[model samples]
Target: MKRFFPIVFTLLYMLAMLKPVLPVFDYVINQDYIAEYLCINKDKPEMHCDGKCYLMQMLEEQNNEKKQNLPAIDLKEYPIGFVTLINLPSETTTTTPQKNHNNYHNQYRFLTSEQHFHPPIFS
Candidate 1:
């Protein structure tokens, strides 16, 4: 009797743990019924009366209707080969050559100097 008590207690605990798992099986079995119940609508005349289909069908129908109602566009109506001309300033010829002083020796005097023997401070 003592050994049977532990076995019965373990079985009860396992069954308690399994209660939550049972709903998943029920949901799987009733999935089709739940889907059919959600899809039904009386207001829309075009939807299937059985309501077994999903909401995607109604959306597809509306999209198709909208596409059919849109005006057709013609590519030929726009002008092709349209050229725009802009007048630019005339180029002037200079007889004298210009001197560039940007690279003069004074600009680079600090970089070329030797570093001090003491450790340099970054700040």
Candidate 2:
């Protein structure tokens, strides 16, 4: 179940990631077979290709397939942006508070009676 699925998924993902190396391993394991049949330079053994060309072709094909599978991005397309312009008057003015202003007081007090502190009664 739950645990088994993650393990299987991880293994599959790793195998997929290692796809490019598979051809190399195959060539290494079956060098004689590949050189005899699948190699491009098998007729001329002077190059000592030993299926290297086939392995390279396989890697290139895999890379091409990966590139083809991806979606291409459009560099010309962009999001539209909007900007707002604001206008302000050039003249500026400042005002001073009066000497007796209540805001000048450092202490504060609430004016309440005993009745105000009690909760309201329902009829």
Candidate 3:
């Protein structure tokens, strides 16, 4: 009976270790957390890849559907035309501020939480 117990225990241990080695166990388990929620609402939805919102796949499909047969011309093979290059002025020009002076400090204040006073101040 002692030999039987040890055999049974060893068999159970072996069974425990016989699980499949899953590299992509994370993606299979956490599908909801990795969904492209933005793309879900898109007019023409696209495939979700690594939880990123991409328009590349949709654009490629649309391009393929609208593709027309045209001769592939190489621009480099054509003779070079007269090239006119205009050099930009080296000096920097300052322009009037688009916004008022008060709006300048508002950028930083928007990012940070507003500071509040606990009690009314006495003059």
Please tell me which predicted candidate would have the highest lDDT against the true structure: 2
List the candidate numbers ranked by TM-score, top first. 2, 1, 3
How far residue 15's Cα lies from its native spot in candidate 1, in Å, is 50
- Arranged by lDDT with the best first, the candidates are 2, 1, 3
Q: What digit string (tens of lDDT, one per residue) describes model 2 on residues 1-123?
A: 889999999999999888778877888899889888999987898999888899889889888998999999875564344545568767776777657755575677887776646687899
lDDT (C-alpha, whole model) for all candidates: 0.64, 0.83, 0.54
Each prediction's number of clashing residue pairs: 0, 0, 0
* Model 1 lDDT per residue over 17-121, tens place: 875455455445665664556545645647644443443454566568769989888867776658577789999987888787686566544456575578767
Better of 1 and 3 by TM-score: 1
Model 1 lDDT, residue 103, Cα? 60
Predicted structure 2, TM vs. truth: 0.57
Candidate 2's C-alpha runs over 4 A off are 79-123
- Give the CA lDDT, 0 to 100, for residue 110 in model 2: 82
Question: What CA root-mean-square deviation does each model show from the true structure?
Answer: 24.3, 17.0, 30.4
Model 2 worst lDDT run, 10 consecutive residues: 75-84
- Whose TM-score is greatest here? 2
Residue-by-residue lDDT tens digits, candidate 3, 1-123: 979999999998886564232213433455456453533434444432543333344445545654654567799888567676889989988997686556345544445658865897799
